[model samples]
Target chain A: MTTTARPIRRRSAFMRNAFPYFMLAPAVIFLLGITLYPGIYALYRSTMTGKFKLEFVGLQNYRELIVDSTFWESLYNTLLVGSLTLAIEFVIAMTMAALVYRDPWVKAWRIVFLLPMLLMPSAVSYIWKLLFNDGRIISDLLGKLGSTLGNIDFMSSTSLARMVLVITDVWQWTPFLFIIFVAGLQGMDKEVEEAARLDGATWPKIFFNISLPLLRPVIAIALVLRGVDILTMFTPVHVITQGSPAGHTETVSYFIYRTAFKSFEQGYASAASVLVLIATIILSQTLVRRFFRSGTEA
Target chain B: MNAIRKLTLSLWAIICALPIIWFASIALRPHNEIIAPQPIYFPTFTTETWAKIFAEWPIMNYFKNSLLAVSGSVFICLLLGIPAAYALARYKFKGREDIGFYILSTKMMAPAAVAIPMFVLFGHFHLLDTVWALMLAYAAMNMSIVVWIIRSYMMEIPHEIEDAARTDGASDLRILWSIIIPMCMPGIITAAVIAAIFAMNEYLFTLIIASQHAYPLSVALANFSGGSDGIIYNAIALVAFMAFFPVLLLVILIQNHLSRGLTMGAVKG
Candidate 1:
């Protein structure tokens, strides 16, 4: 039913409802000014191809993207990074959260684990870049221990650069996953674990049978949030790699960068964005639905 | 078994704490010692590098950009977010769930993907290289945050409060201003804090949209590390400390709310 046509049960509903609308008005203005203007502007630009002037090319930009090598490479790298990072984070966060909850020293351990949450993403990415920064400093340090690369080139190589990136990103963000997982644990009633233990359940059995099932929503939330987050890998790839050594490290973000600002292919970039937007929406909805369901179910 | 469990816990904690320690060690080291073949056991700390950070870059401007962007995004998000969240939580409107997801799905979309178009579009509109652009960009970026964070918090407060406010002759608007908002204060604060941190360290949009005059500390930090004289690792470390210290301070202060929100507020409330 339409908003206006809906029947009001009581006269007070209107008066009471005004508060939420009133409360929401400023937020509405805030979002609209930022999201709508930019979104519409992007949409408008997606239709045009040349100079400051607008030319409507319809779906040509979208058609070009299908054949664009860099676009496909970026798509490949984004999936590769996002999926892998999520897998690693999920396993570690779940196992860590489960184990930590059993300890009496949880408060102290929990606090320490959460420290990285405070570190800026940019800073974390920086440290990762530093960790793999040429691996020269590290290799030399390791070299002193009699470990030589032999014929192995580290950062200069594509595979090694990508590996360094995944490792670094995980190092920086695992704390976030830890925090979320712990929060999920804390929200759970203690009796569930206590009851499982009373039933002669082993710790591993209890975890798989009871705790894991209970924490599915949290797991889902962590995965979805982290999964979506990794797709925009920019800082390290931008600063550390610059999609370097023959665009081996190029992510969708970097691809967009080269196209729009670097190549001035506004239409093409906008077309790529529409596809990105669709993928993001589908993935986010699936993950968030699980989050919403768990919230309501709990 | 007991020892194994304890060891496992300790191992995890060590793994978690090591990176921050690495960062802290670098920050504390003097230039001569920072990038050494072997790290020194004990180090002398100097403010000279940090002092130079301010003197060299438009740090204050960057700070302003960060503060403005974070505060701007948070304020706007709260303004719009509180309402949308309220509508979804309290009302049984048709398509409410869809609407909520519609709002939140934007969060899933990679900023980098959207950013490509934005960079090009901003150039065409002659809006390139402005703090206002950063502000505008941040506002959109933060919409999902405001909506989710505030909505969850609002859910915690019972609808009966609004019902009671209605019987007392309070209009919907009045009830939200007087009752609902005050109740959600902590959550809104959390959103604002997150926004602040995101804003302060935000490198991408600011780096793209704004120029040298508007160059933020993050960009300046990147520029300085390589260019701030290759020899003075101490100075660069000091600069690194300057760029990150404030975020650390914020996280420490608001650690409780932020931690709480991250875990359950969005999902459980």
Candidate 2:
């Protein structure tokens, strides 16, 4: 690894000064090998036929995606789940983070909030699946909550199943939002808040006018991260409903998974992946600009 | 006001502890007493569930696979990630912004999208179901994070040390090993902890690559609980307990990094 290389002494002092450029060579190589190629390759595959004819299909794959029913359903479900999860999580998580941000008594709540985050999402899904299967322990307990709760199949209702998934996702991940929000709040310039308080600004006014604006950058970042996260979520629906009772719970990721693996339609899957990737990039860029144009960094 | 806050904390502790305590007790309790309606708070001890966990299933194999894949990624991340991150941090060069964006963009990538291409790659290499395949996928997925976290930390280190080292006869790699690596230990540990936990808890990639013999503990544990059929409550609870134990211990041991990963910048173990 430490084999000697030719020095840049032959060049002017300016060019020679950049000799350390060689040090950066490997990282760029690895990044290109792993990311740039795959990203570009996905786009390339998206434009080709899957039957191995390798014929160029061009934008037809994009057209098929527009008309693809499963793609639409999955896309709709992804959006629905993302929006619902985000709105609910932000409110609850913000409240929780504010409450626990610097509290000495928060040691336990912090653990409780983060416990599910530690478990693999797939594991969390299975646990919840076991806990909420129609005749499972939770349903059995809810049986006493009311007869309807016991009688109904929790995973059967398209709306209810989606709701459960959204709720489970919120339960498992609210800690992530809480932790970030808490850090954002804790890291704020306390002197600014103290100055506002000396001016006798009401707490609500001070929070709305002061704390939240400072938190916008982080909250936007949290939103983008969580939005993409919930959008691509798969394990829960896979374990809990198997996208079942109907096709209601399958997200775009699962749709892509089944298309590629189950149907052996690699071209179609590639196209779908390209579309999802494009959507994600566009959404991410918009959110990035929204939160970071005035700032910088991903 | 103070009393109210105390009451809230006390209440929340019970809420949090209830599920964890209940799960732990479930693992230790014998089969017959598990379903009793009265609920056995203190049960007679037996080697029953733990012994059954080992004897009846392939958890030990899963355990081994998880450790190997996780540790393998940690080693790879340290070997390859540190030097690269240091360069990006200290050196300002053309395409640096693009390179950083390119690295982070991978963090947002959906595992499902990569599943097919990576699986096809594994097939081409005949690596399916082998630990190597899982390790390769993990290394690829975690490369972005390993770079990002390490770079951020590396930026904080003074360049004067590197300049001083360059003034000596010391080679670049030697400077890295002797000067940089030791100084960046805390940051390296933070990044390693994040990557190791990710590798340890990762399921989707393992599901695609690792089958019965090669499966990680999480995937195997899920299958153990029940798949198409419903779960056997007692047995599933025991498996859940088993699954949580190692991870819970890791979080406690590396509480700071664990919190840092969850939070924005810093928190403590």
Candidate 3:
């Protein structure tokens, strides 16, 4: 009985050891097929040209992107719009989080705030389009206010078009930062605040000197995540403006979509995508590494 | 201070609620009223636009496609993510940290990079323009989120319970099924809900690959526009509301877990 049990026990131990790997195998394989394979294929495709019969182009696509003024314009627009959206979202979300943090009467209002973020972004873009279109809600409201905003075409001017993009993004995404900031605020050590209060720190002083400093990690993580997402803003650009005013408001994602799907310039699009991928990885890696380090420490 | 606080709170609340209220109002208003030179604040509400849109477009077909593709992806995400999450939570193994970071990094990848090759590959395999294509794309897109959220939840469960089950000679699979899963039901549900919301809202991949038969609500809504009569604001609103309503409901249901969902489990609310 002992000898028979030993062999079965050995087999079971092996199975136990292999269990984790067995569980992880499917996800790993699936992710590789979807992410890694495509990523490597994009790299290979970036160096080639032609539709049906492919021919090698070496660095020609990259060279073309370097010279393409529209490519540069799209890149600039992405960064400009990205920064504007992040700045507005951070300010509004932070204010709302600060005001309502731990307030009993206002606690229920959090759900309402989250509604905007939960709306489909595509739908949000359309809603904004309806609001900002010529002779629409925004123009009507502006006209009521006795301003010339009613006559101005928001989608025709580059700055105004970008503003519409930024507004749509902020309306949809501010709640993401709001909820995270609220969570961070709640997760803070109450004792530290109590100690600060006991030491006669004013509310502003406490917020600036104590709370803001302590919330740095959460802020960094939130901003990094939001920034990365904003880098790929496409739907608003597509649905609201279609990069109107001569592609002045075109984002990199939409530009890539047009290049690949519209023009069938697969190789050129792949090159642009690779550049975007590199930028994304570098941006996320530094911030994510710090986050994980702090996470493990906590 | 209390008056000031109330004032600030209500102001922000109005800011948040007004757009959604107006959107629903638009969906129920007459077409001429919606696109009038002056915005009609108190137009007579009607469902004629909704009726018109339903008649003109295969709105239900698109709705069904969205439901099928999103639900299919959510099912796949959980099927693979749960076991992978369990492994990450319970085991300390070689390359564990590296593998975990890789998964998280994939979540950050731009959709464009993958979209190009995926479009080509799907066409190559004759899988383009199908719900199955959307399912596979969305599953890959959201796998990281499902894994991370579930893993974070799994970590919250104490290890002693699992150790006891192990001592009783329960197999790992049996323990996970009978012990861990039932305990982790809330996490599982949250992951599924969040995954569904993201999958349902996904536009780029679906737009690039799905044409006629596979157009989810997102694509269909984007393509829906004013024909010769000018921009049809009311009909667009109806379709937009339809696209978002289901996820909006799911989001409300998982309110407590939302920060975790949005941040891919980086912050717990």
**Predicted complexes: DockQ each:** 0.46, 0.35, 0.60
DockQ rank order = 3, 1, 2
Docking class of 2: acceptable
Model 3 stretches astray by more than 4 angstroms:
A1-14, A293-298
Per prediction, fnat is 0.45, 0.23, 0.59
Interface RMSD of each: 4.7, 4.8, 2.6
Please list the residue runs of candidate 1 whose C-alpha ends up more than 4 Å from where it truly belongs after superposition.
A1-44, A51-60, A144-146, A150-153, A293-298, B30-32, B35-45, B120-127, B225-236, B243-245, B252-256
Q: List model 3 lDDT by residue over A253-295, tens digit each.
A: 9999989988899999999999988887786677676674322
Off by over 4 Å in 2: A1-22, A40-62, A146-148, A284-298, B1-47, B168-171, B225-243, B257-269
Winner of 1 and 3 under DockQ = 3
Which should have the higher DockQ, number 1 or number 2?
1
Which is the better candidate, 2 or 3, if ranked by DockQ? 3
Angstrom error at residue B55, model 1? 2.6
Residue B257 CA displacement from its true place in model 3, Å: 1.5
Residue B27, candidate 1: C-alpha displacement in angstroms: 3.0
